[model samples]
Target: MFALRMSLVILVADVWAKTPFMSEYEFSRRRDELIREEREYAGHLRELTADEKIVDNYLEYLKWQEFIATEDKFLPSVGLEGVLDDIVNSKVFKTLKKFPKGGNMHLHENHILSKKKMLDIVFASEDFEHLHVAVDVPESKKWRLDFFLNPPAGWEKVKGNPKYTKEKLLPHMTMMGSMTEFAKVNPTNSARRWEEMDPMFSRLGSKVIANVNIKFKYLESYLKAALEENVQYLEARSSISSRLYTLDPDPKYNSTGGKRYIDETGGEYELQENIKFIEGFVKKNPEFIGMRKIVNSYRGASVSEMYGDMEKAVRLYHKYPSYIGGFDMVGEEDKGNSLLYFMNDFMKMYDNTTGKSLVPFYLHNGETNWPDDLESSTNKKDPVGTLQNTYEAVLLGAKRVGHGLGFFKHPYLLNKLKEHQTAIEICPASNQLLGYVPDLRNHPANNFIRMGAPVILGADDPATFGYDHFTVDWYEAFMGWGLRLQDLRHLAINSLKYSTMPKEDINAAIKDKWEPAYQRFIADIKKEACAVDFDASTNAPAISRIAPREGPMKRSTKVYVFGRNFEEGICKGVRCKFGNAVVPGSYISGQHVSCNVSGLRRRNRKGAGKSKAVGVAVSVDGGATYISYDGQFTFVRNL
Candidate 1:
């Protein structure tokens, strides 16, 4: 029996050898190739243009330099707060700031302007006279601002008050002060983070923006700040309910039931007022493409309250179809009533069973790092678990999901999101700072982006978080995810692609507005390569020597300039200066850069026309600075 088994085994081996089956190594090699192809497929949405490819190479090089910088530290190991200063100062981040990020799709209206900017605007306004601070409260609860027609007993006006200096007022108005306090307790405790964060709105955001006088100016400043940061569009989530009132002096005005102030506006009138304000803003800043309002209600509300809010949102949508973007529930998702708790309320917004939802939902779901089982009960009476919200959000037809920190845990939901082409609005800085993922590299948006799910970067409550504009979030994602330029371009395009903007308008903006601005930016950056007079600063490239020191100045001569700390990338602003003439250069490595030594502006010297030893310098940061070595280049009659 043993001899027969051996004979069978030998026969099987002979057959396998004759049939030419692949070896394990060969199989692995082929599989590896497929994996590489799939990775590229996942990373890129579309083929990059020639100019975009150039920028991509430059961005890759900039990323390499960032990894090498010692004090800047790698972004993943040190959280965003740890490296905020470095990111703001990074050359890569500076260039990204210039990028025309299409829209800030998922921000609250009150949080648009930074607290510092908000305070500055308030101090400059006439409302400063009536604006009073609640300083009598406990140390943690101080610096609440509100407008009063008649001064309450303890409330004090801000003007000339020694107590409320800008520096003193800033920390209370922004999250940084409270964030520091929260960190001292437990940095990773998300509940603690939210505990510190929630009251900030009541104290700073709601109180200040509730004043009618500040709302318009605050929005104007937001739009202006967006334009300055090259953001052409916005879809801010705002509650257009009836609370805004301007302070006034007329005694008869008190009879109008203005809630302690005159000239009150709310509900439909408030919506119209905001629409008018936006229209005026767009008209004034033509470069600012447009703005839309995503009417939002807090998720913490009871079902009846949420239903009323949803009904009001639908009415507003119908009344101002062009101006309203969608509907959402804004707040800390983990502690709020789950989407399941409002399923019936959401379903009521639709009719005929198959009819589309009257109010498009842009729900903020899965904004927590909590496990699904932590609060498994979907009952309204019970505290909610967040991951289930992602499921309900998808089921309810959310146009986009905000945060989505826990979405990756559900494979089915992730597939459904991709199938629906629903975008995820990722607020990296907010996520990191709010204690969801201290290491942004572990943020679920990374997986969402890799899986080809539509992803847009946003700043959620930038002001409350002590950040301004969308670039800080962009920097976080770019660094944390190791994003390529193609990824950024894809995200920029996705901002409009997934926006509430109509299809035709989105296409028009992309073709006529965003595309032109993008191309112009590329052109400008490229052109900046040859400009001279760069401000020299720390970390500037230091030259060692030049290969073939002699070259003809009249014609183009390629010379390799050896240097340390030389930036590698497409020469956006990087240049090689020979005497007075600066020319575009190609970055070779940390130690070498090559430049076309042509058109050297002949220096006015004693040796008028002969070969002269000229100083050669290099600038890596858009002529912001230059570095030169003692080794000189001879501009000869001929090489």
Candidate 2:
């Protein structure tokens, strides 16, 4: 016992006595010098005004690091993971949580809610009369949430049916269902995994489209969430399946006594109604900027079909202009038909006039590992698919391309992207989830910024990965990717510069909004950095917490889907059945079906003095079974 006690004392002495490897005074002096150098580094860094959150982040990091270096007590070694965890939970993280994410040019419509809200807002609403879920069997069965215009006769039969219970739905709700769940991208076989991820995302988008009644409410909710996270702008991508736009139909006012949102009796509302709703929302909350909608022409579409979509998009863009901005090409790039496949036909209809192209495209290019995991043997024939897509997007004058991750593959591609000032919508979370980059530390974004190529951060499919707003995406890039404060400002500036907004508006926004915001940011930095170094002699500021970035510095995109059958390519003979209503020559092509709902007649106004209105149904397989769209059409007599 005496020997053991003596040994313990000797070990303690060994650690405390000579562990300094220098005199205690010298150690303290060197530490102070390092602190002074750090302060100097912070001062010299660019974009001081815009980097307040980053400054706060660095200060917090230094404070903890200083403690580790100066503390006399013995401490256990922490791994890199532990350090990252500390940063994730740090005050820096909270500050960054509210950093002004200038704009999210690339985003999916369905994934606005984080994990908790997905459970609460969506899955929890299963009790609603109109809400019904279909579990696609095979991959945990296909889980789809839909709204019923009128409760089908057998809806009650499946109410407690064991097959469609909450237990059945849970598998597709959380991380288990998110095919983009975190995992090391296997270089040898990421191809298969990425393919699986697509259907999962597609499935989610379709479900959300099917449940469009409360969409306006959700739009408000989504923007409110964006404001909380300090996102200034957003541009969401979704295909407008049909030209006919639908909102919550008032059942009682139409003819029905029940509260079926899509009941035919419910009167049809105009596209302008929803637009007005958004205009009011933005006017009410100055902090909430509006969202912009971009429609997609599914790449898998036929040449004529794509042209039809482009024509409709141009019409919408001309009519709404600001509300509906850009037309994009969306789908799995490698598997679907290439852009070149439609170029011959696409150019024929490019111009609004004889020779001028009015509708600009936002293409998705370079989102794949071309040589490594080709989607089809056909891709090998065009070995430069990624580069080709990038070129095509530029040639076609795309406003931006989402996930142009493979830009570095060709040296000239970077130069061209820079020349065009074409922004690459960087969705780190989405790309990582889909196995594009694998490790954020090695992300090509750093190179993109250094070379002055336009780059912006976005949350592609935020809901699919369980995120509430844009914050999760920006935060992940800020920390996980080792981006400093200055990098963040450059990104912010690029976002505004590359947006589809008018040049004059962009400049005014920068001068009026960005300038003032930056000034306030600098002031906040100065406030938190008053006592950074703690030497009795030095005047270094104390590293204190700073305030969160509050409200949008400017407006945001208030986007809502404009069409029905959001999925492109209406199958052959698929008909929208609305009970003998005069169909105004339906345009049937691919997934999109557009008919004039104005011809729809019901008992309320024209059809009868007293009769209940049911609803309209779409038959994908020529009436094998019927599915409902948002608004229903009824038969009225000849005018």
Candidate 3:
């Protein structure tokens, strides 16, 4: 019975010993896996370090991705719909929701009127004559009088009887095309027909020309619309060329006729009238900020003529410092003499004590994309050079630059502008419509903003373009430039910051009004976001990193390995074994930094064979960089 019991005991002991051996073998397999993973991770790190350019590119890509994701989260919730409705209807609109509209820098007085208003002005004018109907061969058919009646000494005369109304005039007018059919060959007197029809059509056509009286009426209505849309300021280009009430002698002298009508009326009277009207309206409703002057000389005028006009403008400024704000050379750039032609006169006017510049000068410098010859027909020697004239204007001390569309093409000038903190007024829709650039996205304004240029947004001529200031321009800028609410707010602040308004007033508006409004907007956005539930675990996947290992060796060597998590929280620890025991050191986690294994040493190596080494020690910290690896094997080091 004792011998049988001994044999059973021996059998049990042998089975127990075999169980430990199985465990060590499994542990050894795992150790091999961990070492392979470590080496692969080290290889990846080395590769990334060697190619910094690639890493930088990747980082930039990551930044853009983050920006896009952030925009996705924030943009949709902005009160765009509410803002639009408010722009259309609100009477007391002070802010443009989140948009920062700069100024109406490119408005021309003649184009501000509606088509209906223009038609009314033409039809209602008591200036159409119903005299003997005569047809001209080349230009126009006209109803001419035997002799033109001159007005009394003080009052200007009308072409027709003052009693003639729109109802009476519709039957007398004859429309013609292809000039040849319009002119009847007067067999009796060729010279008489030519002379009579020439002056007749000229007089009749003057009524239909862009009228400034209609423009003033249009502006009154438009300003109300703009105020509802929350437009803060306007600077319109006004000219004395066509609206002068006073008469001048015709340049072409005639022996028989003493004087004929010339369209030379000093715009000062009209300017003053407009100013008074605006001031009176603003007094009742303080939301309407006043207007600034941009005196424009026609480009078709001679150098002397332009200089004379400019001189007259200076006199106007001197006469009414508060009303006439600044001076500008206006008209088609191609038709006008180069601005350089009047540089001497400009300097004289600029330095004049009598007409000190109360308002800032903003030049419409380079509005062309064509070659110099293409820009001008009369002066074909390439007078204005390329669009680089904008830079020259800046050097000559223009406070603001208008239609600086060629900014990107001049890098040095761009850099100079950046250095000088000069702002560029971008009119995206106007530029596109006028054939400056094709698309809003490809507009150089985006490039300017990205390159850190001080940029302001403007509506060149919203009425002419068949759009409102807010909808077409502000909306396009928002969609095209990828601008966020904060960016928009900053743009608004910038507009006020660079405004010609007094510094004290700007500060009051910013501190007392805009800042609080912006804060409320941001708070509202955050409140809306917080009410929603977010499940990051379902939305975002976990990324893993391999734990690092270190050991004392004859020389520095790198190991590499690769692995992926097939399931959530699957990444665990590395294990090694020797004889009948299992050992563990390194570990990895999805959320935190992985453990480092350094100062690891193999014991019982030669006797047990390389594969059956006893045990290894590791430092969880980087060697020398964070921890020391002593000869004595220890898992923990005293910091």
| lDDT ranking, best first | 1, 2, 3
lDDT for each residue of candidate 1 in 21-132, tens digit (9 for 90 to 100): 2432234344546767777757564666656655655566566667778334676545555566777788878888898889887888788788888888888877777778
TM-score of each: 0.77, 0.64, 0.52
lDDT of 2 by residue, 1-639 (tens): 999999999999976885553432235344546656654433323534324543544433433443455244211112111133343454555666555666777876556645445434555443344555544345543454544545433333225567655555544654325433233325223465556555556443444433444455566677777767766667787666522223345655233223334423211232465478777877887544467778777867877898888887787778777677778877667666777777876686565566556677777887776643344525433443534676677677777888888788755877788788788888865665555665565667757766667788888776665433465456556655546666777777777777777778677656665556655665666455443332232232121211111111111111111233312111122344445532222222212343333332233445353322335545434445545544432232321
Q: Relative to the true structure, how large is the alpha-carbon lDDT of every model?
A: 0.75, 0.55, 0.46
Off by over 4 Å in 3: 1-102, 113-216, 241-265, 352-360, 371-378, 508-639
TM-score of 2: 0.64
- RMSD per model, one decimal: 11.4, 30.5, 22.0
lDDT of 3 by residue, 227-270 (tens): 55555556667675544221123535343122232334555556
- Evaluated at residue 289, the lDDT of candidate 2 is 49
Off by over 4 Å in 1: 1-32, 43-45, 70-72, 138-141, 181-185, 251-265, 376-380, 529-639
